[model samples]
Target: MAGPVTAAVLVIGDEILSGRTKDRNIGYIAEYLTAIGVDVREVRVVPDIEEEIVAAVNALRVRYSYVFTTGGIGPTHDDITADSVAKAFGVAIDVDPRARAMLLEYIKPEDLNEARLRMARIPAGAELVPNPVSRAPGFWIGNVIVMAGVPTIMQAMLDQVAPKLQTGVRMLSETVRADAREGDVGGPLGAIAQVNPEVSIGSYPFMADDGRPNTNLVVRGRDPAKVAAAVAQVRAMVEGLRKPG
Candidate 1:
């Protein structure tokens, strides 16, 4: 697009903050968005509080191209994401007929209790993001997309929402095994990085299978030519530094 298509993830849940439930959506969302050319710039977790959710949503929506929220739209008192999102956008929220209809696919009319009805609340002027795992629909309002906290449900929502988002150029990456300790290559790597400012260079240290310290140097950039050039420089540097057994 005009610039990089960036996104922020707002994870809302008391269980996540309390550690009772481990979060599994952030990484998945980040990787998925990256593959689709949307850079995930930030991630924030908030307890099930109205003010915190509102503030996070408002701030992130303005700062990034898209905001994806996970959790707090369930059938309980603590599930307040829909209402908080409505307040953030200063819009009215009510049980949307379309959402109710979707829920009906799973829940019989008599079984759709008051608590379950909470799942149908959607902000005005918002579009629904369907959950293939569960019938409860998430929503997209302005630049924010609210989704279920459950990993499977959230993933389904993202797939439904992906085709509609504005995307940017995909990043290209190259990895070279240094077969040497990270410390051994830091200087040369830093020098390469300084000259190739267009590409990002990173070193990941690991223990080689032969019981020696080693590093993997990664070069990444949106431009293929820049990434290739940086990779060539890194390969030459590593070759010159190779140690004899």
Candidate 2:
């Protein structure tokens, strides 16, 4: 059987680090990858510095099956993820014919200024991750996948890249609504989690619509049977806690 396929997300933008742009890409990428049997294990937000982007990409690309970076691929001056990624791989970069053609599809030949031409520059031997929303394409070199920062464009690029990625057994999760606080479930849940070594048990505390304290006991695992068993344990515990003393 194939082992778990894992990935890391490298969010590249000065706005993100400065708290100017509320990042919407990480959550979307994580959930999207999870549904497709790819586990996103690490997420790092970095400034728009070329060195930082290169360092983060190198670090994550080696540690995970894939490293996805969103941001810094635009036409503006701060869009340096492409160059930094190329630097990391020690590869030459230039305006690729394919990316340039894609840009021409959206922009008139007469209007393809130098600023817009910057979007077509790709690292040597990188495969373009198509952008359906906008013609500007992202690129994938080895295990590192570069994408746009814009949520809509990034999602479109991911759609093009997903078919090429390796997938593993999809993680299955079951949630048990525990009408109790985390404190009530922590101990028993901890014990249950310790016994079920392969399953992940998490307790999320929230308020109900009626304003009552509620906890959600989520059991996640690759095997449905194991998840079901863990959920059964949680349900039994919740039922036991509700019974009058």
Candidate 3:
């Protein structure tokens, strides 16, 4: 039994909860992580409050193998993600030299005001996660990775961070169609699933050519051989129940 690689996502902003912004990061991260064999087990959306952000960051970082946070790292007064995450880890927040240098490379000295320099503040002893879309870098403290909330920037940062993560065996899926009603095949499908506890089998009903209900059974597993074997078992079971015209 291979241990599952788990991850959690924290979306920090009042805009999301207040319905002012529809979150696109969660779905994008979920799909991206799944493709790389990491199971995203939990997701949380918290307001811009410091205590709430700190608590959420602390709890998720401890619970998951990897924790990803998005939003609240901007120049606005509400951007307090860095401070909150630092507090969560009991670390000091300061303007990191590397981050400062990066910002200075692109931004003029006149533009590097207190507001913009806020982006340079990172948790002590944290490593920088590259933000190709913008010079403002994200930071990684322990298992928690802080990234930008903007979808494009988040994706770019993920490209840099994803390779560093350890992954599990990729999940495999197999599908087969049966000219039978879902109700008719439900019992056998459940029996097959019980017999092969390692694989997950799902049956979806659809209309057939003859206007009768048919089912498409899908088997998924981390092991390709196991998935194929389970699919065969389901196919055999369904074939056995086929009626002669």
Candidate 4:
């Protein structure tokens, strides 16, 4: 890649905003893309409105290397993501023969109702994203990729789309768990972070399953050497701050 590979996610659904549907695709997509070396820098959620979808899609597609949208591709009338994506690219849309064929693999010819065929409508000049879970394929035009909102179906589409994306260096991470509190180590951790500008350092305090308070210090960077070096300092700091029982 010529530059850092980056992406953004656009989540579309009134149900999600209304709390009727809890979103599960964003975190999965983020982790999946990160593992493949594509940094997900931003995420936006919009209602079922066509204008909002268009605005989010257009903005994110230009700002990132890839923009993946989840939801609004079902048989119901509220599924307007396809048309909104088309509007974003200023392209005309129609029921694609190939998409209809995919649906036929799942739906019997006699059962292929008009509502079901609505899933086949795709933007002009866009390529189809195969949906192994359901036959209703998503489509992509330019840098924007549209996928189903359902986690399983969206994951299947991501697997299909992954090979086509341009990836970057995978980030390296190191975690050091200490029997310490965040406030007890925040000062030294902050100093370590200042010296290691290349790596990101964080301190997380949580109640362990055993009901004891503990801290986890994490270091992340594209360079393994830097991550290792920074984490070494983190371990040293934790050890030096240890209290005698």
Candidate 5:
């Protein structure tokens, strides 16, 4: 059986680090990859520095099955993800005819200034990830997939890349609402987790209608039977706790 298909997300840009541009990519990508059987194992945010981007790309590309980078692919002086990624891979980068042509669809030939041409500069031996929303395309080289920072554009690029990726077994999950505090179930939950080594048990705390503390026990595992079994145990534990003394 194939092992898990894991990935890391690298969010690059000074704006994000400075808190000027709030990131909306990481959570969306994580959920999207999870639904498609690709486990996002790690996430890192770095400023728009070439060395930072290069180091992060190299580190994550080797540690995980794939590394998806967002931001810094725009047509500006600060946008350096393409060059940084190329430097990490030790590849020569230049204006890609394919990317240029795609941009020409939206930008006129005469209007393709040096700044706009930056969007067309793709690393050698990289496949273009089509952008349906905007003409500027993202690229996929080796295990690194470079995308735009804009949530809508990044989402479109991911959709184009999804069909070609290798997926692993989909995770199954079951949630049990425990009308009790998370602290109340901590000991029992720990014991349950220790017993079901294959399943992941997590307790999320929330308030009921009356504003009393409560918890939602979520059981997740690749195997449906195992997840269901864990859920049953959690339900029984919660029920036992609720019994009148």
Candidate 6:
């Protein structure tokens, strides 16, 4: 695909990997990125360990056009995303002046203690990502964009970051239904996909009126005309198969 802006999501936190918290960030970010024409290529969930975070950050940042990390940047003891990311790039971690000033605007001095100042600590040479609801900001180092784990905070941060990103062609999808089973449609769908390589064809089976299984054919692609053409071809093939036999 031309001008494809691929991204990877790094979900850092022991709560997520251990199943203590169900991750809602990945789906939200994926939908948001898709809407803006950025394709989410991969997602990795890492624990609160520094080594894991650093490794994931290093790996994803190099592979994708953008790497977005959520969680572990909080004010808690387990919040090590910033330090780990800094270590990944061999940069010093310190309280950024701008971030500190921003935090000071909202939080009291007592609130900005050691535990809280940890939120202000950012990797050197990184640009700050503004958090509108909360003053504590996320930071971007190289291709990696680190944001909060909380759904609301992450959404706010994304709103600020989305406008700055380079986006690709938005993907469009269409669906067609058939009385045929998934197995019956799979072969034809695969053939159609091969013929229209640009379009992605997916066959989903569901219970029909007679308690028999039927298939739903979904076609998605960057080009609307290509997707439509593929869907029409698949529909015609299914209709022809349903004739008098």
The worst-scoring run of ten residues by lDDT in candidate 2 lies at 48-57
Per-residue lDDT of model 3, residues 1-97, tens digit only: 1688899999999999999999999999998998998889999999999999999888888788999999999988999999999999999999999
lDDT of 4: 0.92
Candidate 5's displacement at residue 156, Å, is 0.5
Query: Could you tell me how far off, in angstroms, the CA of residue 154 lies in candidate 2 after the best superposition?
Result: 0.7
In angstroms, give how far residue 54 of model 2 lies from its true place.
1.0
Q: After superposition, how far is residue 177 of candidate 4 from its true place, in Å?
A: 1.1
Which tens-of-lDDT digit does each residue in 1-245 have in candidate 4?
Answer: 85669999999999899999999999999999989999999999999999999999988888999999999999889899999999989999999999999999999999999899999999999999999987889988999999999899999999999999999998777899977888888888999999999999988899998998999999999988889899999999888888565
Which ranges of candidate 5 are over 4 A from the true structure? none
lDDT of 3: 0.92
By summed lDDT, the worst window of 10 consecutive residues in model 1 runs over 236-245
Model 5 / residue 69 / CA error / Å: 0.6
Q: Write the per-residue lDDT of candidate 5 for residues 1-245, one digit (tens) a residue.
A: 19999999999999998999999999999999999899999999999889988999999999999999999999999999999999999999999999999999999889999999999999999999999998899999999999999999999999999999999998777889999999999999999999999999999999899989889999999998889888989999999999998
Q: Against the correct fold, how does model 6 do in TM-score?
A: 0.92
Instruction: After the best TM-score superposition of candidate 5, give how far the Cα of residue 97 lies from its true spot, in angstroms.
Output: 0.5
Candidate 4 pairs with clashing backbones: 71-149
Q: TM-score of each candidate?
A: 0.96, 0.98, 0.86, 0.96, 0.98, 0.92
- Residues 128-183, model 2: lDDT tens digits: 99898879999999999999999999999999999889999999988999999889
| Candidate lDDT values, in order | 0.95, 0.93, 0.92, 0.92, 0.95, 0.90
The CA lDDT at 88 in model 3 is 95
**Which has the higher TM-score value, candidate number 5 or candidate number 6?**
5
Model 1 spans with C-alpha error above 4 angstroms: none
